[model samples]
Target: MADETPGFELPLLLFAGFRTLIDQLHAELARQGHPDVRPAYGFALQAIGRGGATASELGRLLGVSKQAAGKTVDRLVALGYAVRADDPADARRKVIRLTPHGVDALARSAAIFEELRAQWATALGPGRLRALEADLRAVAPLAGVRLDVPGWFGG
Candidate 1:
């Protein structure tokens, strides 16, 4: 018999699965001393990366206005997740870098994600989970990972 799932259901199901993972991540984060971290912050932190970025650079990476990026920086600073420091190569520029706290949160998130994936694998059967991942990789865009999801989602 042909699959009867509606075309519109595919994207919605994908999004729901993504939401489930994120929701589970945030729940774990809250228990591990990062209750304030939001989904948007994850994308912003990834954009900032190891070397860090100026507000303008971050804004471009996140596909948002400089002011929006600055606001995110402000919040990160207030939450002790990041700091603004003078760029060594360019004293006039201040770059936003992740703090130890932020690094810990990211690390914890990574571990938690692995656990979540394991849970999914157990539920769906390991072979099915692997197949799902392979199928997703095949269909997903070839442009590499994107860091502008927060802005794209209008968050």
Candidate 2:
């Protein structure tokens, strides 16, 4: 049974929709035999690919404590998607980089996202999709949301 709410809040509705899309993306990834590749991993890969970053810098970018960022790096290392190496200028600090496999996975995931966007356009019509995008772009800066994952949602 569905709850008969008087009115739905726009932000909550948008969040639900976003979650649905993310869930679908994950499902597609699992179907394609990707193992343990969570959305956070994709975000991290994007951050590393843009430029190598230390766990502390990643934490600052992700709006997380350094410890939390370290844990994410540990997971990426375990999954063979990222590696930590000594910084040339500062041997005491380690920098993270995406492996070739990680790059391939990110590319594949991007392809999947494009397919999903096409499906959305088919369902909503190109005009409406474009309008929604415009609305988001106009409103995003007003929300002041922080990125908890490196590159998620254009962070």
Candidate 3:
């Protein structure tokens, strides 16, 4: 059975689609022994960079509380994907940066993304895929959207 109520079906479908893709990649990561590969960690990795970021900036970017961001950061650091450094401008603050191992993992993920894009293009045809992408962009949710992901429709 499906929801027959007004304006409910599309959102459900969207969530299911997102969840499915994430689950597929996550399962693959798990198979490869990549621990702590949750979506939250992914979002945090995307927020950090070569130099890194403060917890408050990550919280603001991800629409989470500072506490939640700190937890995610701590997890990444523990897993060796990130490192915390004292803020040059403010001694009390700290910034997060991707480590060398983190860069390697990120590169692997980028390869996966490229492979997925090729498969999609072959299955859907370039023209139709572009149209589909434009349609999704038009309907995308603005609230709580994370922009740090490697690429959205642009990659």
Cα TM-score per model: 0.95, 0.83, 0.77
lDDT of 3 by residue, 1-155 (tens): 99677798878987797776677666766666565677667767777766688988887766677887788888889999999988889999888888887776666666666666667789899899789778887777455366544223223
lDDT score, candidate 3, position 126? 87
Model 3 steric clash pairs: 52-96, 53-96
Candidate 2 residue-wise lDDT at 74: 97
Query: Tens-digit lDDT track for model 2 on 45-148?
Result: 76677468999888876766688788989999888888999999999999998887777788878888999999999999999998998888887863565555
* TM-score, ranked from best to worst: 1, 2, 3
Instruction: State which candidate has the highest lDDT.
Output: 1
Whose TM-score is higher: candidate 1's or candidate 2's?
1
lDDT of each: 0.92, 0.80, 0.74
> For residues 5-92, could you state the per-residue lDDT of candidate 1 as single tens digits?
9999999999999999999999999999999999989888878888899999999898889999999999999999999999999999
